[model samples]
Target chain A: MNIVKLGYKNIADRPLSTLLSLLLLTLGVGMIALLLQVNRHIQQQMENNIRGVDMVVGAKGSPLQLILSAVYHIDAPTGNISLHEAEQLRKNRLVAAGIPLSYGDSYKGYRIVGTDHQYPELYKAPVSNGRLWQEPFEVTIGATIAQNLGLQIGDTFMGTHGMGEGSEIHDEHPYQVVGILGYANAVIDQLILTATESVWEVHHHEEEKSENHPGEENHAHEEADEKHSETTAHDGTPGEEREITAMLIRFRSPMAMIQLPRMVNENTNMQAAVPAYEINRLFNLLGVGVDTLSTIALVIMAVSGLSVFISLYNALKDQQYEMALMRTYGATRWQLVWLVLQEGLLLAGLGFLLGILFSRVGLLLISGLMEARYHYSFSGGEIIREEWQLLVASLVIGLLASLLPAVRAFKINISKTLAYD
Target chain B: MLITRSLTFSYDHRATFQFPDISLEAGTDLLILGKSGIGKTTLLHLMAGLLSPGTGHVELMGTELQTLSPAKLDRFRGRHIGLVFQRPHFIRSLSLQENLALVQYLAGKRQDKARSQQVLESLDITHKRYDRPHLLSQGEQQRATIAMAVLNNPQLILADEPTSSLDDTNCLNVASLLKQQAATTGAQLVVITHDHRLKAHFQNSILL
Candidate 1:
């Protein structure tokens, strides 16, 4: 019989032990697969958001928190900077383009971003239908928000006061959904964008009427007066005149990243955060656990290798007489060793298949949860190249595991074994 | 021809066997009768090149079995020696025909389907050639092992208790078949057993 056939026979003879070993190997490999795919997906999402913004400027606080809240729409914003201070930074000759973001409002769980028309232009996100938000109380929804809320171009919705659900709603001034942005696989596709004036209108509608007295009503009714009347009435209004959540700054030169953030912190109350630095810091913090997990996996694989050796050793001990009989019938010791190692290869190969199967099933379940709660999309597809490497590595380790038992088989005393009975 | 000279073996530092000289020519059937643990199986193993004698030399056809390396000894044994164990030790996973084919392949002999079938037919196990050893009866498994042993047509046939578990009729049949096949191949046949019922079948006898 060929070596492969012999290996197959050995595995078939001990079906339960073979299956248990394979299941253990699959657990280690499957975990590595899931971690690798999720890490890749997160990195892709981060890079997409960091493309247009060269620097982030927010009120003095943790730089990492500022970047997380600004770029990924995850954490809460650090406190706001003054509007006059932001306008000064925008006017600098080194600055190329700046887009301001006003927050503190949301619809359902999705953040309602109050920014200019340049906000969508900054992300290069095109409106899938209708026009951009131009009038007060007009809004443009993201693709996911539109789909989930079943809101079309003409549908109107009320904005809430805070970021999460159960926040107080501004039922007095309802907003109309005038447009929907196409999917960009970024944060823009998961937020609601409108004019900055719309945010001021919702919060300062009561303050506007209180300042218009009986004699000043005729002046407020004038065309030019009506435009400046709201600004004059709430001149100290924190909601209307206060700074925004964060500013996205792009420099004309890449060297501005190094020279500009230091200049901003030294010259103003705002702090600048570099996306790359914070991302690396985040990975370093997370990488320790990932590395520890990988080390544990390697150790488990080594144990599994020893398991293969011990099991094969026992099997050879039990089959001594049979081995001697084969030897007498012209079988070489090297051929016998090959037969044992072949079993190891078969076990590893089958275990790898099971590992890949479990990874896909795991990814599918995770994707369902992410889509339902966070509205994030995940695709089920072929195994990536890195996952394939894990499989090949497992096989190599298995082959190494079988080496000791194979050597023992080669050194067996055929004559003594035959003569013992 | 098989020859041994001053062959000595020990167990636990105590000498168990000392054969000064013995030679068996081709086509001779020798029945070895000994008590249990008398080194009968050991002597057969020495003649079959399965064990090395510490004190002296054993030669089969012209090559000294003691002078060869372990690897060369294994190859020599596979091509020149045929051994039947006390109980048939067939590889349980393989069919009877595959068992025979593996013996031929390991001996570097071309697979001869006609010869394999003929051996099976002689043992009346031709119908069970495709069955695993576990599916066969004790006598049938023993016959299959015997068929595999003779598949390569070795220079010497060594049987260790060939009829230990068989009925009287089957024992006589197995003994006659071993002698007939050895005579046909012009090979020396050595039967090592404590069973005295097998003594009358062979002309030459050694009592230990």
Candidate 2:
């Protein structure tokens, strides 16, 4: 009865053409939407995990690897730095807070981080039950580990000798869960936290057993006495000869930005990695990939717009009689023009809606695969603010594509058309 | 009532048509008969304000259509003039009832569902009220077209070649329907056609 109804009928009359145009539009929109979501998720993950830790200092190696391992907990650590050297950097006037991490063991693929209370504090993670680890063998599990491993308070598990699932078991020492941290949605959610002495004690005990007893299990009674003495020695003592994987540093002022990394790189054997710089470089690398994908998506969108134009222009020729008929029904030139434009908009609107749904479905599939591969969780239901710009872009494409066809409809010679009919 | 004076049209200055001045009172039928290419369709378009003549004034219900701006002229034509083409065409997406409703809407009249139903009933096509135009038979579509034309109850109705494609019985049926519907609405009806069979149907007849 109205232009919209007529437009819808016109589209329905050409299902194949409509579907082709819609498919192109959906793919283009879906790609852009997927890119936006992924870029936002990566940016959020990187920013949230960094959490005000200004620099990472570790044994000289890839600085990015140090930040990724010690800060993000997603890569291998850049060897170990002496605790004496770590303490020296912590005492610097430019350093506000220094959180040391010793990572050499794992519990079911989840890294067991040996650190003080500042590790959880840096990520604003609080204990949901019990308390922070206070002793060598007492451990606090992050929320995800506790849920995945189903380890409640008072449950005990022995650590593995390496930082991954398959490694030599350190059965000489057992770690008990003293607390479970609340979910902080950061890297800390996937870690198990313990005091720095736990990692050292586990390895140190292994070294003692290897040197003194050489795989003698019957010496368990003698081992208990040795552990009892070692525990007393661990209390209130800085094991200066021990080494930690890395130290997370916060600058006391902006002056440390220029002075601290330069001082560490030149004067010490440790390498200082600025998180902001590393993350920026990482984003630039990722941006190139995303930009190329988005450009391809935009080209697809442009092609779809052209398809809409061609479909409408071709349909206009076939519907010239119909246009003349409408004029006979007293439709004005503007109404005829609106009819074509509405057809274009209807196509775009449907394509945009289906495209968004397609993107969300794709995100759901991608999220599942990513979680299985990387153990990094990405939620799929977020609607980014940038999608509004995509909406406007689609509408403009629809409008522009329909322009000539609508004008053709406007200038249709009603008398001549009907005369031939 | 409808009146046209000094109506003339030329196509690209190659062919010209000088139409006979015509007049008709309310509730009457006039047939302008012509063979092919004698400007019969052009004359109907001019009266419907779909086209402007080379020289003339078409006064329908006391308004000179050519004097109005294109927008106003379109609005005026919608409000006061009803057109029925030989090949009946409806917005194919709309149902029979919706097609009638659209006529009233485009004419800037209040949409009265009851009035549309009554018009379809008078045309005896009310049984197909919700059916799409394409689903209707040829005769039913023609009646639906008449329903659209008379839906607005305009003072004047111009039908272009209403029975040119019909057999004798259908031709007579359509002509009587136009006359009967115009009488029922109290509107002047002008039907242009090349069909010689319709000449006996209208008392006021002219040859172009």
Candidate 3:
């Protein structure tokens, strides 16, 4: 019986137009929200994982790929670098600490990273049970690995020869789980960590086994051994040739940030990639896609507003007699105006809620894909500040769309309209 | 009491109307008869405060309609005058019952459902209360309009061609209904129409 009820009833009576407007609005708002959440989660995860690491020194290849592999643990390493060469750089006066990472094996597709205790300390990940890995071939698993594999402390698993699934199993060098880290929401959550010798021991066992047992190793095994020895060449020291996939570096000061990367790239065989700089380049490369999507979403939002305007404007024409009739029944001009405006506001408010729900569904699907592939998921729990601004923008669009129709309702000539009717 | 003193109006110099003065008492019924193009609806609108008169004033219950602000005039008209149009207009989105309820709300009164139901009962269209006005039969929609016009029990009930499109029997029936509802509320009834079949229904008639 009130104006709001009347406006809502009017909108409900015209189902097709109302649905068209709502659909457009939902799509527009949902796409924009999905893009915002995706970008926020990516930037947040990258910034969180690269907090303490200053530079990543790895085999020369795509620097972005190197950062993605070395820092985020999502992609494959470019190639292995000599542990002797990495150690010489780590011992420099400008260096504060270096966490060496050697990962070429996986247990059921989850990477087993061989690094020192400082790798866990860099992420502030505390051991939840048992203890950190100390002996070679002793593994400390991350939270996700333990939960997914149903592995507990003291459980044993063989590492596969390659980073992907279905690789040759290294049953001779099976890893025993010694500890499990708590959920740190970082790259380590998806990794199994151990001492550096664990990864080398797996490959070194293969080389020795092939030499002792003749006519057993294939060309792939021979090639794997050759690549392994090339990166782990001896520095005039016999019987001890260790290689690492990458070294995560931290600087003593900002001066080292400028000089150390150039020194490593020019004077050494290893490639030094700054995580922050590489990630920025990656984002800039990704910016074109994001910007285009945002523009499309914004255009959809504008089209939704236009649809709302057309709906209201068209309905106003049909309801002229009713408006005059209401005036004759004692409604003032402003009441009629408010009635139209309220319809617009109701559409906008409902569209916003439905759009957010749609975005959340989209986020769930996207996070599922990301978690399955990269073991990193976006948290859509909290609404960001920009969405609130988006809400304000939606309301303003609704108000603007309703403005002319409301004015027409307000200025309707009741006497002429009623007489003509 | 209802009073209008020589109300005159014009529409952008295209045409002008000099309406006859009206003075009526409470609880009395009068029929104002005029053909189309004679400003019959105009005079009714001026009386209902839906239009501004070029000259003169309409005073209802000792309050001059011209003296009130636009907002105040709307509320005053809502509280004091009930209008029934020729085509029995209703807020198309609302059911017949809600339309009646909306009328009481517009009059600044609480939406009294019992009163609305009772009015529909008096008009004998209570069975169709939940139906939208457009779904009702022509006779039923006319009854619903009558029910709406008397929902708030105003002091004046103005009907513009209220029976111009009905048969002789339905026309007389509508006229009696309007008069009976007005008498029950102790309000003055005025039906302005050219139908002349309602000429014998009301006690007082004025033809232009």
Candidate 4:
């Protein structure tokens, strides 16, 4: 008796074709939905990673690499800048805070970030257990690193010579885990933090005992060791004179951000990288592929619309006699037209529901892998506002697709149809 | 009541068929006997407001069907007319009850579930009420179509070779059902057919 019941019956009458068409439509919409979700997550992750840092100053190199290494824990540093140069930049009246980074070693695959105590404080990272690294050979593991490696605060692990595993180990200077950071939903939760001198000392010890250079090796190693020891002892700190990979710069005003990068480039060898600008450039490069994928999804959606039209038109042809009989039995042309339009609208509604469900499940599966591999967090279970707009858009397309076929039903020659029957 | 004046129609430009002015009151059963291709179905179509007459006026229940707009014509036909074809034609996707319900809805009539049930029972198709037309037997499908026709209680009932597919027993049963429904609804019944076997069932006859 209800119109929706009639619509359902019509679809059930040809189960195979209806199912195939529904699946096609669902796939098209699903891809678009997934793309939208991923795009949103990428932008969100970029913004989250760049949240606190106002600017990045490092050795003159790729601005994108500088931001990547400083803001996000990806890519190697541009190069190291001297501590005296960094101190000079920090002396500027516009500078509010500066956290230095010295990274050259890795534990397993996770980066071992050597920096001052200001690093965790600047990033607002709190130690969930134990304490910050206070000794040269003591390190604080990130939440993810601790969880993955099953390492406790007292556990000790040797750093690798390179970023990847299977590299030669700096066996003489194994570091002990002193603390683990809480989950911060940022890059800090996926790295190991240590003192600046620890990383330099690990490589310095390797250079001292190398067998290939017996003559100058001892002299160079002795001089390096003396200076290193002297610096560590003079400052009453483990490693004050060691080089750092980059510095996270926070300014007092927007004018400082505009003025500081130029000063760093001209007055010092360090490069000033703007996080927002680098991230925007990265997105701009990635936008072309996303736009192409979106275009493909849209094309598939249009094809599904056409498929709806063809299905309705074919159904009309096959049901002409039935239409005529209905006409004879007091069913009007408008009623028949309504019946066809209702079917199209129902397909749209069902397809959109399935699409959104697919998007969420797909994002959930990808979220785990992306977070593990790239340390980027995407909220998989959340439904955003834009998905609702996609559902409505698809439904409108379905309605429009059915309009022509419904009109054809209205204009059928009832007399001829009855005679033929 | 049904009235037609100077009814004329043509399929192509070469040939035309004409009918003299005729009138029939309610509760009358009129048989239209004609050979093949003689515009019998065309006349029924015009009477049912499914087609426009080339040069004529068809008045059903005091309203000129030819003069009404297309939309009003559709509504008028749905409310005032019931049509039965020789071959059973049904919306295959819909069950019998739903098909009947669609007629009631289109006619803008109060849904009479009891009346639809009664029609199905009278046609001996009550057991097939929930089955789609494709699932029903040929005679059962025909009977279901007849049940749908009478669901709206229309004033004019038109049949275009309604018994062509029936055996003698079924033909007689279908004819009696048509007559019984027409009498019950106070409708003027017009049967258009080339089948001569149906001649004895009606008292009034128009030979074309």
Best by DockQ: 3
Native contacts recovered, each model: 0.69, 0.49, 0.77, 0.66
RMSD of 2: 4.7
What is the C-alpha lDDT profile of model 2 across A1-421, one tens digit per residue? 5667768978997888999999999999989988888778878888998878999999898877778878887776767788888899999999999998888577887878889998888999989999999999899998988887899999999887555455567897899999999999888888989998888888677666756886664343243322111121122355656788889999999999999999999999899999989999888988899899999999999999999999999988888987777666667889989989999988988888888988888888887786655556776466778998888888889999999999999888887887787
Identify the superior model by TM-score, candidate 1 or candidate 2: 2
Q: Which stretches of candidate 1 lie over 4 Å from their true place?
A: A59-61, A79-84, A104-108, A116-184, A192-243, A262-271, A377-396, B1-28, B55-76, B93-101, B108-136, B153-155, B177-188
| Alpha-carbon shift of residue A98 in model 4 (angstroms) | 1.2
lDDT of 4 at A282: 93
Name the Cα RMSD for model 4.
4.8
Model 3 residue runs over 4 Å out of place are A212-240
lDDT of 3 by residue, A275-347 (tens): 9999999999999999999999999999999999999999999999998888877889999999999999889
What TM-score would every model get versus the actual structure? 0.80, 0.92, 0.97, 0.85
What's each prediction's clash count? 0, 0, 0, 0
When 2 and 4 are scored with DockQ, the better candidate is 4
DockQ of each: 0.54, 0.50, 0.83, 0.54
RMSD of each: 6.6, 4.7, 2.1, 4.8
Q: Give the least accurate 10-residue stretch of model 1 chain A, judged by summed lDDT.
A: A224-233
Q: Give stretches of model 4 more than 4 Å off.
A: A104-108, A116-183, A194-241, A257-259, A380-385, B10-16, B54-56, B62-69, B110-112, B183-186
Give one digit per residue, the lDDT tens place, for model 4 in B1-208: 8999999998888999898787998888899999987888888888888888899889988999978877778778888888887777677787878888877877778778998888888888888888777678777877777787777788988888998878898888888989998888888889999878889999989899
